[model samples]
Target: MADASAGRAGAAEEAGPSIRTLLLLAIPALLIGIASAVVLWLLDLVSGWLESAIWDGLPHAIGITSDNPWWILVVLTFTGFAVGLVVWLVPGHGGPDSATTGLSSPPPPIGTLPSIGIVVLISLAGGVSLGPENPIIAINGALAVAAFARFATKIPPLLIITLATSGTIGALFGTPVAAALVLTGTVAAVRNGGSLWDKLFLPVAAAAAGAETMHLLGGQTIAFHLPPYGTPNPIDFLTGLLVAAFSAGIGILAAFLFPYLHAGFHALRHPVLLTTAGGLLLGLLGIVGGPITLFKGLEQTGELLAHPGDYSAGMLAVFVIVKVVALLVAASSGFRGGRVFPAVFIGVAIGLLGHAVIPGIPLGLAVACGALGIVLVETRDGWIALFLGVALTGDLTLLSTLCVIVLPVWLLVTKAPHFEIEPKHGLARPPTALA
Candidate 1:
């Protein structure tokens, strides 16, 4: 027994990272962090430039107004054609289905990076109502793996993935803490013989580096100014609970509809035809919802929050409904992007409606709770949902209220199907005899 115990102890000690080893790992992690942030920044810049050229410059130079609905429709439909062509012609089928993917999935082959990057850039530039989180993470992960394999052969691919993802999360949210919060459940679930903090050391280092770099570069976060929550009251708590539950219910409804929508798009059976049709429909939705409802909802969300009084209850309701449909269309219609940004926009609209209806509830609480509800349903992570609520409001006061509201919301969605598409299964075809 003593020999066995000593042997186990020796194994544990060997498994633990030495200080010198940690320092070496931190150098590569920091480099990966900087590289990830730069890639994201470049994507944003390129997408913005392309979107401007397509949506504004082209129309202006051609003596047509982009404001006209017909122009918007034509451009988006053409965008569909372009993306469809790429997907059909490019190997790897334009990467995995975003509808079936999470924020981070297993990276595709290194060879697929170029095609995926092109499609994602086009989608972002063409006003697809999705964020770049998933593809950007995939790109960074793949690149990190390739680079490490070439030079640092001892680094495991899984560790590379974790570092890259952490860096990207930090860059995305403008804070290292966001990565830590998102990764907590994952790290805790691992049965590795180390303390939780010990396991988090490299990831946290990478995240901090990414976040600081983004900060230095003026990265955007989900920030908005809202009236403060003056005091904690039962009335406010009850209102938050009700509002969160209601928004969660809406998210659940979307969850139920997701598969049907995905199948409907896939039923077309070819990337070109399916995407073109999807684009035309998305263009129509853009017309109905106007410019605010068109894109991934990050800038539009800020715009909506900037002028809260400009919208009536009816108008706010329309915004919510239209954005939700647009999000569903974007996700289902072969457009590759993350759903969380649009979901945040929908949650904001819902909160605005709540405030409009019940003037008594604090606006900050209403918005935060609404975000908490929908984000919980969308991401299925309480920490993330709560973080989003607090981040969106730029108020620490919403934290406690949001934490409490998440409990009931989780219960409501615990057994529900996630916002993911199931992988299709089929037997492989036999090879034909050579001529």
Candidate 2:
């Protein structure tokens, strides 16, 4: 009896954290979630205010409208210069080259958070085409790690990373579900002795808290009220597959171009020149694609969906192309941001184009598949791709159809290079040449 009891205790210890331990961890996880959401909310609040001041107030104060081509050019160029100055002069150089970082990359030193925050805000407010997700995650993760190190000395750094990442993802997407799906692969890869959900407990708790906090704070939803996808038909499957595959192909092409673009821009050998040149190119693209093609693209996705009838097939194609280029430029040119949001916009445009070209396919299905393919290629996470696809449409009915569609899309993208740049040196150092 004594031997058996000892054996049971050992097994339980190896099985992972006990229920009591997990429950205790949940408390801190919840707090982390709330804090994470607040950080995101604050960033959005300040960025939105600054965005309005630049695009609305300043434009109105000036003689020309905000959308004027020259004004767009000047604003973007100036934005690049300002961001470059921060990178060139500011300590921490804005937390590594955004091009070379992933959404869940290890957090930069806590001291760098301020410069990262500044560049992110400038990029966001100045109509740079990247989203706040990457930098915000880093910022939140660093803060969480620092706080834990100071206050909860016993908490492991890896666990802190998971909690912070889950929290921020939940807040960004307005749902804990997104956090769960995004982290599924990571958690499952661990060879620990816990049930998957058991391993996920703390992270999920943090994600839920973050998501709910964001909701209570009135964060915008990613879903749009499109016509529901009621039933899946044979033709719908074929169409969905095609759209997904097509979007994946486009994403792959962009991925192929990404490294070249990074190299070309970095060849400028100066942060200010590279970013300013990038801004000029973005300005020209904006003039061609107009204001709708600029920015992180969440609001523009809604606008595009709200008035889908106003755009033609050709124009929709323009939106996709221009946004793709803008995403590449913003990312490769030292701007601090994420690719997912702009990729979402591109997927939406591609879907709309499919619908316009082939009126037989349901808008919701096309859009979902489009987003799935692009997101799958970018993030290389099928679960997240599927979640965003269904979440964007807010239709559970498409889940089965999307599950099928994603298989071939996955096959299409599985072999493609990921949409990330691997820096030649440590963390893509700032170019040495000042000019």
lDDT of 1 by residue, 147-240 (tens): 9999999988888988898898889888888888888877777654556777788888888888888888777777799888876888888888
**Model 1 local distance difference test score:** 0.83
- Stretches off by above 4 angstroms in model 2 are 1-14, 426-435
lDDT of 2 by residue, 240-280 (tens): 88899999999999999999999999999898998899888
At residue 270, candidate 1 shows an lDDT of 91
**Would you estimate the TM-scores of all the predictions?**
0.94, 0.96
In terms of lDDT, the poorest run of 10 residues in model 1 is 426-435
By summed lDDT, the worst window of 10 consecutive residues in model 2 runs over: 426-435
> What is the lDDT for 163 in model 2?
89
For every model shown, the clashing-pair count is 0, 0
**What value does the lDDT take at residue 236 in candidate 1?**
87
Residue pairs clashing in model 1 are none
